[model samples]
Target chain A: MRVFITDTTLRKGMQSASLELTYEKRKELFFLLSSTGIHELEVGVPAHSEEERDYIKYLARSQHGDKVIVWNRANIRDVEASLECSVKKLEIAIPVSDFMIKEKLNKDRDYIVRLLKEIIPYVKSKKLYLSVGFEDVSRADREFVIKLLECIREEGADRVRLSDTVGVLNPLQTNELVKTASSFLDVEVHFHNDFGMATANSITAFLSGAKYINASLLGLGERCGITPLEEVVFYLQLIQGVHTGINVKRLYEIVNYFIDMTNIHLAPNKPLIGKNAFTNKSSIHIDGLTKSKRTYLPFDPEVVGSKAALAFGLYSEKANKLCKK
Target chain B: MRVFITDTTLRKGMQSASLELTYEKRKELFFLLSSTGIHELEVGVPAHSEEERDYIKYLARSQHGDKVIVWNRANIRDVEASLECSVKKLEIAIPVSDFMIKEKLNKDRDYIVRLLKEIIPYVKSKKLYLSVGFEDVSRADREFVIKLLECIREEGADRVRLSDTVGVLNPLQTNELVKTASSFLDVEVHFHNDFGMATANSITAFLSGAKYINASLLGLGERCGITPLEEVVFYLQLIQGVHTGINVKRLYEIVNYFIDMTNIHLAPNKPLIGKNAFTNKSSIHIDGLTKSKRTYLPFDPEVVGSKAALAFGLYSEKANKLCKK
Candidate 1:
């Protein structure tokens, strides 16, 4: 099945300390990301700042307006801010776990149900595609999560986002979570890479029937970041046979441009877009690549606008081969 | 169930072009890794160089000899080299995929079975714990892989390593592969991270009853590297309830030390050991941390000898809170 993507490079990515993009730069980023034909872009949190609101207003009225999704808190002010931007799609996030409800909001489950009762229909009345995001749902009581899903679905919410806010869910757990969440409403998954399982969990969530997968340009977000957009897209195309309409070849260019704009240097060994992702050093691996690219390379580097190279080093057998010749 | 780990930091890690650890540095890394109580260390490929052979001899005769496993190719010369090191344990790697067997080795399946028949008994006769590594097994024909497993088991091979040399298998496929392999002999899993799924695949392999999981520090290896040792160790302890007897607290320190010794700087968002793994900048997340750390953290950062901190940025609400106070 085809999967939809909601890349949050402009929202969750900007929330991290490392990246700080101005409105003009963010506008540039929007076009670059949009060029990939991503299904949606969580453009910005309208309530975050006047500049954020202005940017949301610009994107909400742009040619790609249908592809822009404004993020909001489960409050009237946040809703009003997005409404002012004339955004056609929005996600209202609320803490779902009991610990978060009590500590962060000083409320109970009844309060959440009441908040959803008001927010879900209010957004629906405005004819916006509303997604009720369950923040920290991975740690929420399973029965309560189901109850919340029913609550939102009953109130006309179009989707429910299973946010692994703390990055605690493994693939197996994600499968069960998505399976349960999808039975009620369209499912979107947002994961943190805290334990380095976000890519895996996102893929599992999709296989288990998640419709929308939330990711970022380079998995750039809170703490260890989120699922990487390039990873999910390439994986689906090459391995799962699920073709996302995204332009796979533009991935490296987009990620490189983002890195250049943000001055974030990825680890050379970072998967997919890293400098060394396709570079082979060992003689054994080089030999394998010499015979058949499939022997050492996962997918052709050209699929993502990259190329493979061999670096002669401590393990180079090229010298021996040349000597024999 | 307690899971087993065979870290290949000095072997596969060193094989990469970026890292060139001298024998002395490897000795230092050995002690650092050994202190974590890792089940085994694939120290190095003894047949690669004279220095490698000497280092293998030193480790094979040391106090941690039983914990060391020398790597070899599926050749008598490689086996004899390991024997000269007096290594009590060794793994003979042979290409198993049709493409690799045909192109890399210019041999067929029958040749593989023949090689295993001769080599398995030869290694077994030496009273060494032998693991038959099926390189590129992820792309091998399923029936042929099973047939080879039967051949190795009949020849008295103690373990079979399912090596995802091209990093193609996802978690579900890994589960099925490991489940099938474990029935014939003890199972070890080694995966590359080309698709950014090795950590997930390795964890799934363990959950599917594979006894041994191979990893490298920082996931360092060929191409985009292998499954990371830290990710697997932390994931099992915090998420899966599989307590590997590893000192989790030493993870950051060890990674930092390795980085200094190798001059490799990881992405700040690198999970577990990156500079920003526990740093929160977003106002909402910092507020959550203020109320309760669990609201924003996957696990206590101190578990990995790190601490959480708040950095004021574009999204900081701390300024408003302080003004109200």
Candidate 2:
């Protein structure tokens, strides 16, 4: 029930093409995220700019309760910058697969591991809560993944995060990877929603034994975005009976603030925070729901600061009549 | 890899409040559905009105190549009307849960089973492909569900549809129940997206062994709508390696037609059909994707008649620069 939300909006969400939160806006957003019970923030890459580095440093020092985590590559300079910024948590992201390391980073598997071993101790020397991220872990070989985790654990890294960098995993695969990895070390899941499986994958990871999940508000990240915080919070609390320490009612408010600030339209069908998540439009459903809300609802909408609306359309006269009455 | 699409927009989607497709519009819609490669069309309830019954008959006769199924309650009158309309497939809907049977239908479990037994033969006598619908099947007791399936199977029902009437199922439960039920009968899944689990649950059911799925175009139905046809089709074909009989390239045309005919706006983030489903917004993703679309895409969007867009706002310049270079 001790759920940790690692907000990747500054890093991953910035990848959302239309979203442009300035450095100052990013700092302001952290305060808003903190108020929503987010325990950690994956602020941004320190390698981006001196301004970005200074802002990350400012947030690391100035933010009161929230753990300011810096996302960085396997390079020592990025790790050192993150350390210099005094980030409480340093996520050292290393591409694990042949495709990413060879194609993207132009490095071999051994070099990636060697790079992590070299940088992790430097991070540990700074006494930072080190979470080594295996980028594109889903596509990485299982044995290689195990080897990397073992190496990281031996290097005194605090934990390892399984990143579904490409969002290619299904729930079953997610469970297998998380469970297998958890047996070796404390594992966290950082899922991408490229296939719309981010939230589901994250929940499966949690249920399968992963303790920490990486989430961004509204599933906002690069490509399809990361795991949605609202969805993870709702499922963990309602279905799994786990407490996330989230003020459930404040979810809508926080999401709305981000929508307004980012000028991104919240899709009405987006899970949890979307307009249609809690609304009932069918007459048969409304009639049954009117008798007992449980007849049509998994959980009360009010629990998530959502109100049920009567969707008026061709087949919803009963709901319309009930609403009118 | 053979996939089947059952459009339930008329039957289930019409149940939404303020959604009224006139008889003529309904017929036009039926024709439109038939033009698509959709395998089955669940036309409206035959017992709803004289007009509904006549329309069902007309569609059953005219909609060649597409199996016209009629929704009916587990009652003699409804079954007789469905038969009179010559619907080759009959989905006899009955509340399977104690809550629905007792509260909604004011009947006991025994009475419900008896009703099914009595109606099953009447429909089978007409040589109709019968699919018994267990409304609220997710909430029903597992043992009772097994028993109901057994009775339906014994009574010669061709298939059994497990309706997540209240949308109470998570992926695990959906898999377990569908797997168990599929062991007894040809299982079809009908899901409501009340908790954003409809598409996930439908896919889970298919993975668990269910052969048939019910979906509405654009996810148009009651409450949060049914399983999105586009999501199911895309995931099945792209991920599960299943061949849905749909003309993949024509999907966009069909979606556009539905949007125009219904005047329902497709949310920008809707999977497959939505404008943003294939749009790249992140600089990292755009950089990689522009080089090779496969870098971030699970499958080619053009396969489903969708083209990826470069969504630009705050994240535009860097991503655009990377793409242009």
Candidate 3:
């Protein structure tokens, strides 16, 4: 099955302490990501600031403008701010878990139900493609989620975003959650990498019939970040035999662009885009590379527009002997 | 089901360019890992260097000598080196995939069959507990893997290790392979994180009846590294209700110790151990944390010997209002 990618690098990626992109860099990143053939680009929360709102406005008028999705809290003021940006698409996020509703939002489920009754029709009336995000869905009661899904469907929303806000669910759990949500509406997913399973969970969600996958460059976001765009894109293309329209060749350029714009130092062993992802240091791997690249190489580094090479390390003497042989 | 952890920080973790522990630091790390209640510690490859052999020998004579497992090639010389160290346990590693056997090892499957015929009995005869590692099994033919498993079991080996050398397998694939191998003998898993699925795959292998999981601190190893010990242990204990006998509270200390010893900088969003793994930055997350920690946290950070806190960022204005309320 094919998967659709919604790159949220500019929005969720910017909220973290690790990355802060200027307006020009944000515009540059938008264009760079647009070239990658991703389905949508979640640019920013218009309600966050006037600058953020203005940036959303600017991006809405830029090339590939239809792909821009403005993020907003499920509130009238946030919806008004997004409307001001003239964005065609909006993702209205609200806490669905009782923990989040009672503690964070200081509201009840009825408050959300009533709010949705007013906001959903209002946003749809303006001809915006509405995507409702259930924040902290991982901890939400299953029955409550089903009830909300029915409510969301009745409101004529285009899709539902199940957000694992804290990145707690495993692939099996993610599969079940996506299955439950997909039964009612088109499903989008936003997974965080808190337990280092975001990529796997994102892939599982897609396998369970998710139509949209939210990811970020280098998995940049709050806390442990979200599913990395590079890992999800390449894994889908190479391992699962699922084609996401992302230009696999441009991944390195996009990753490098993000790093350059943010001055963040990625570990050399970072999946797909790390400097050493294609480098072989062990003698066994080197010998394999020397004879047939398939032994230790999963796929050609060139598949992602990168190169593979050998290096000297603790196993150099053995590698040297193999070479001599 | 209970899972056994084999911490390979001193062996696989040191192999990556990201970490090069000094001899003193290596000894320090050994004790640090020892204190964490890990089942076994893969100290080093004895044949790699005289220094590594000496370190293994030193560790063998240390307090937790029985927990040390010396890694070796499936050759007498490597076995001889380990025997000299007086390490009671050994993990004999060899290329098992046709790609690795024909290309890297420059040997046929018959050659490996003959080698194992000699090596397995020879090591077992020494009264050494043995674990045989099949490198690059992710790409190995299913029939060949079963043939090897049958051969390995016939050779009187204690266990078999399925090394996903290039991290190509996903959770579903891992479950099937672990199931296959478990039918013949006790199964141990060594997964690479090339696609960011090592932690999930390792967990899946355990769930599918693998007794041992080989993990490195920070997932450091050749090319994208292996599963991170922190993620695997915490996931088992907190999420799956599987007690791994590892002291979860010491994970932070051990991770920090590794960083301090190696002078490596981990990303603040590195799963489980990052600086921001417990820090909430976004106003939505902060508001949740201010009300109920569970609103945004997957688990109490103190479960892993850490604390959670909020930070001011782009959404501080909204967060400030939430705090006032």
Candidate 4:
């Protein structure tokens, strides 16, 4: 029943078009998200720049509840860089699917499994909390994912992540994958929104017993972004009756801040935090709300630090007509 | 194995903020959708105004593969308005949930059942094709839904719609509801994206033997909106191996056209049709694509009449660094 969110806003969120967030903006997002009860922040790639290393060190040294985690390739060099910054947690991702292993790394599945066996012992020896991510596991063989999970589990890796790297998994598949994987080890699901099922798939994975769910603010990521952090928290609270200890009433306030910092325009129709996510427009809907807010709204907007309103122009006109009648 | 899409762009999409499509714009959109092989189009609400009547008439009389469906309340005047336009198909949605039937309509479920019994014969007498939609069916009692469906079937309704009116149902619930209802009759799922799972729910419903899925251009509707037509078709095609007979290559074209006509801003991360849906940004992803596009991309962009490119700034910089090394 315990579900923790790992925020990748600093890593994946920065990959958006012209969304290179400054160090100050990163700190601001980290502070806001940390207060909202997110369990971990995948802060930055310390292997990238000296500034990134310093920022990771700063976040690690900060008095936030969020466990500052660093993203690294499945190589010792990236882990060494992160270790130099005093980062205690690391997520080492390796391409696992045949397509990715062969094409991306010019290597095969055995090469990746061997590489994991090679790099994981050093990470464990460094006394770093470790999560081994099987990148593109959605396309990889289930046996390989299970074998890799077992391999990591034996190697003293604390957690395992099965990434829908290309965002191709349907909900049913997502549920089955996580259900099977969780039986073996602590499973996390890192989903992308390429086909727009990431939020639902994340819910499925969580319901199937994945302990950790990876999300990004505003669903920002490489292409279509990941499952949104707000959406995961909102759905979990309302749909599944699960509490993540997050201050959901601060959801929109934090999302708006992220949007302001990134300069990315938010879709008004986005769930929970969108401008119209709680706005009642149609006269029929407004009239229904006048009698019962639950008539048109699924949940109270106050849960997300927002409120419902009768959409100004036409709703007023409709009310006028009803009055005359 | 059959999943038919009913596009409601002209009807629900018009409810978007300040989105009033001119007659010419509507006509253009209608032609574009028709060309893309969408099975049905829920044209404008002819009962709304005289202009709406003319627009419905124009679309109904036009040559296309789409069956023109007119939306009506659980009353006869709306049907008569549609009949005047020679509309061949009708979707009469009645509130089925206790909350909607009692609070919104100020009537009980039985009243709605009797009302359906009263108005359905007249619609049949007009020799129009009929589909009875149970608005808010997801919240209604299951037995009540079954009884109402039996009532509609007895009244000779052609199809039935089970709406998650407030977007309350999750994917598992969506599948069960649609599955159980489909056992009795032809069931279509009308989902709202209030929970941001409409596309997944729609896919679930379809996979669970529901025959029809109601969608919109950009998922436009009353609040958060319905499942986006593009996401449904894309998921069905790529993930489920289902052929939609859709010219998916024209997916982005129609979406861009809808945006241009409505002046609504498109989300950069929107699945299938967003500006960033096919854009590759991550340096690691771009590096992988250099070996094979299949490494990172799920489907070819040409399938949707789009192209993929390395994200402008950082991806280029990564390639430059690699070249210098």
Candidate 5:
């Protein structure tokens, strides 16, 4: 299945405490992401600041191949702000959970539904492709989520996204929610990694038939981040035969650029991209690998643009047992 | 299901390139693991060296609460070395994959099976409990794996472990394998995280009725390492209600001790134990949290011995609208 990726490295990635990407860094990463077969980019909210607004506008006018999608709140003012960027696509986020509606947004669900009814058509009139984002949908009532989607679909929204804002859902629950929501319309999944299952949940969401999954460079974003782009692409490609059109060779380059910007060291054990992911240390494993690398390798590390580093220790030496019986 | 954890911190964890836990460090971590409600400790292989053999013997004789299980190869010599440790239980690991048996052991599967026949009775005569470990079983032919298990089970083996030595299996495949193997016997899962699904695969193994899962103290070990003990226990406890008998309060402390000894920094975004796993941002999440934290959290961080650190950003200030709504 063709899995579309919306890499929000420039948008949400800036929210990470450890990252402060300069405008040049964001532009560099944006083009790097485009080079990695990423078709969509969630350029930051234009309303965040004048500089950000200018960057969004500049990105919209860039002669890049990526589809520049602007993010904004449910309010019409944010939509008005987005128009200034001249982006052809927009994502309007609204808090759908009762607690979030009351406590966070300080607006009832009815207020969001009413606002969407009023603003969606205006967005369509401007000819911007649109998707409505349900913020914190994991904690929202499923009935209410379905109801909201139905209304947004009726208003001619092209797609819907369920944001696991608190990163609470497991794979099973993610599957159920995505399955239910996709029944109403083609759905995207935006996940946070608070519980460390974001990548796993992303896999489950795809298994449940999610069309779009959000990932980021270095998984750089707010608290615990989203699924790492390299991980989802590699797992889906190697294990599931799903393709994200990512150039595996460029993954290390993209991550390196970001880590250079933030100086944040990626975890040594961070799945496909981590330092030790393909390091073989056990003597038996190394011995087996010298004869047939497949004997000790899950996949050729070069598939993800990495080489196997044989570690020095008890298992590093080729022992007598590895010889002919 | 009662999930058994065989913490191989000193055994397999020693194979990690980045770790060199001194004898003092090993002693400190071993006692700490025992305190974490962990019942089984695969201390080390007695065949490694005089120092390692002495350490294994020491751990076997220590007045510790954890059951010290010694590890050895399929050969009787390794088994003989394990007997010197005086451990009541042992794990005899044999390569079942054709490539490993041929390349690593320089022997055919038939020779390995014959060796098991010779060694099983010898191990039994020593009055030691035993579990035959299938090394690199993920890539092994299933029919052969099952056949070997049937033969070993007949020899009075207590259990068997399926090691995803190359870390190739995804969750679905993990479930199928564990399900198939557990139907034959009580199966423990030992996973390496080559593709970053080790934790997810471990979770799936549990869901598929696996009784024992392997973990390490620092998520440290050979190549991508085994599953992070903290991630597995935290996810299971909060999401699955499968308690590991661990004192939730001591998780951070336990991890810190290992990190301190190894001088390894936990990834800021590492799940459950990462710096930001419980960090909250976005004014909306903060607002919802003030009214009821559940609205913005999957589980209380305090449950994992962590507290929420509110991020200072766009939503850090409590706005007027939140109070009225």
Candidate 6:
């Protein structure tokens, strides 16, 4: 599977919970995730804190296996901070929609385009991989998004990340957007789970020709976090027949470690790594699942380093009783 | 604006982690939810236990305002049990796809039709409001769904429920399915949160043409639960201008009570009632939000008895300093 894992534990996951990590802790996490085979580490915005910038620089110098990506606004100051940290990849996030830009940034589409054109060359001068992020791209005018992609490509950006900033796009919209954007440039998908369409949207983007996806461990990020890495990895490899290059056996270990380090509880219903993702409760479902897993399961739980659990409650007899039989 | 609330706490919420309520507890919850202005309540399956049958019958007799719905399989035995329990509304659930019917039931399409035709009349004979649930309808062939809807409608089913049984639908698919089904009959949507598309799918279903939706408190159910009642209520009222006789200000109380009673930890990122749903984590976001609540919030959190939270981590200094401010 040609898969890429982006660890958002430092960014989105921490924001989702009540916990806060120091600069040293973030550096530790970046090193750990990089060593654990994650392809990308979304280190927090370098402009946000001098300490964070120093930590990103430390990790960039120390960790050699994975790309260190620093998130920033479409501003020269943010771009310069990221470059000073020696990060290989910089994500310049510019809100594309009139609603977001007008309301959030008090800027118009013309200003957005100008901002991207200005930042792209500055990052390229530092020899950093530039991934232009179109914030709230789903709500953005389709023509605007297409134009943004073209401008980013023309400006020599390595890739463009289509962000469903508010998590509004469904799979069909995701497919349409990604397909249109992919025609002009290498597309990446960054989905939030606000309305819980993140993973599905990401998969649809992949199917529509996006080469990279922005995901957090356990779908962690602001709001509902980003698309879950584990879920996207599973779907890409098992269902869509895509190559994600994920070490499936180590997925659970990574989840547990992140959970332990962050103290954020995974939603029981979270796909792949959630407590009950593979658990069967109904007697009928358990019976069929036990007879043959395909009767109830979409993908083998073992493929993601999870075991099917048959728990007893309102729906079925005790799993131990079934085992005894 | 016209809206309705259907609480599936008994049917779907029971599927949450380690949640097993006695017959009396279910009845108590029914009364509590009914008193809180829920228009409908999905009581447990009468086919499961004699106590369930007695409790459902008692609740149906006593709870005069709320529509008491008993969930059942499209089988003679299940329908008979629902009738015996005195449920006024019968939700007859049946597999609609060739994959589900053949793999799960080991039955052909002809057999399923025969079974539904046989049971629908018996259900209608009791003067019960019948809603046929097409399980996994998203994966089912559209032609098959249309045929089954026609058959059930002719047999006196009051409405049709399109179930995304495995939560495999995206918003586009949900809109398409609901729109297609609406062309034939009044449609209700029952979405699972399996792939994290439940809320978006529910919204799209509402936008497309669905009049009713199945929801559980806190989005609790087997594999990620159904669409969350709070989210649907909020979105319909705030965004879509639809009113659901729900006392929106009391939503948090009901959600918290259910969570505490069940001992299930609510994910901070859960929509509507989640801790982070109204939180502003980014500093820039906080600045815009302070300028105008509309800058960051899609809808007022107070509409659902929630206040915006300012949390810290990756996004901004203003968000981190909200508590201090």
TM-score of chain B of 4: 0.93
Please write out the lDDT profile of model 6 over residues A221-287, one tens digit for every residue: 6665678777777666665577766666676677778788778765687666678877777776676
lDDT of 4 by residue, B120-179 (tens): 898999898898989888788888988987888888888899888888787777767888
Cα lDDT computed for each candidate against the true fold: 0.87, 0.76, 0.86, 0.82, 0.78, 0.75
By DockQ thresholds, what CAPRI class is model 4?
Answer: medium
TM-score of each candidate's B chain against the true B chain: 0.96, 0.94, 0.96, 0.93, 0.93, 0.93
| Clash pairs for candidate 1 | none
Where does candidate 2 stray beyond 4 Å? A63-66, A320-325, B1-3, B16-36, B63-66, B309-320, B323-325
What DockQ does each prediction reach against the true complex? 0.76, 0.44, 0.61, 0.60, 0.48, 0.37
Q: Kindly list the per-residue Cα lDDT of model 4 for residues A38-99, writing each as its tens digit.
A: 88989888888888888888999899723799899988898889889897799999888878
* Tens-digit lDDT track of model 3 for A176-197: 8899899999999999888999
Writing each residue's lDDT as its tens digit, candidate 2 over B1-325 gives 4646788988886754325678898788777766667788898887767878888888877836237888887888988887788777889888988988877767788898788888898889888899999999987888899899899999999999899886667777777898899899998999876555677777778878888989887676665667877778777777778877776567668778877777765445555655667777755556667566765666777776667677665534556576567
* Top candidate, metric DockQ: 1
Q: Better model by lDDT, 2 or 6?
A: 2
Query: What ranges in model 1 sit over 4 Å off?
Result: A319-325, B319-325
Residue pairs whose backbone atoms clash in candidate 3: none
Q: How do the residues A1-325 of candidate 5 rate in per-residue lDDT, one tens digit apiece?
A: 6989888877777666556667777777777778777769896887667777887778788876337997888877888888887888999988898878887667788888898899889899999899899988988898899899899889999899889987867666777899999988888888887756677778788888899988887676777888777778777787668778877678767776666667786777666666776777778677667777677777787765678876666544553344423
Residue-level lDDT of model 5, residues B1-325, one tens digit each, is 5687778887888888677767777777788888777869888888777887887777777887238897898787898888887888999998888878877778887897788788888899898989889998987899998888888888878889999887777666777888888888888888887666677788788888899988886577777787888878877877678868776668668886667666775677777766776666656556667877676677887776678766665423453344446
Tens digits of lDDT, candidate 3, B1-325: 6889999988887667556567778888888899989999998888888888888889999999999998898999999999999999999998887877877767899998899999999999999999999988888889988999999899999999999988988877787899989999999999999899999888888878899999989998887889999999998999789989988888778788767767776777889887777777787777667677787778998777788966656656656676667
Q: What is the TM-score of each candidate against the true structure?
A: 0.97, 0.93, 0.94, 0.95, 0.91, 0.88
- Evaluation by lDDT, superior candidate among 2 and 3: 3
What number of backbone clashes does candidate 5 have, counting pairs of residues 3 or more apart or in separate chains? Answer: 3
For the candidates in turn, chain A alone yields TM-scores of 0.97, 0.95, 0.96, 0.94, 0.93, 0.92
Using TM-score as the measure, the top candidate is 1
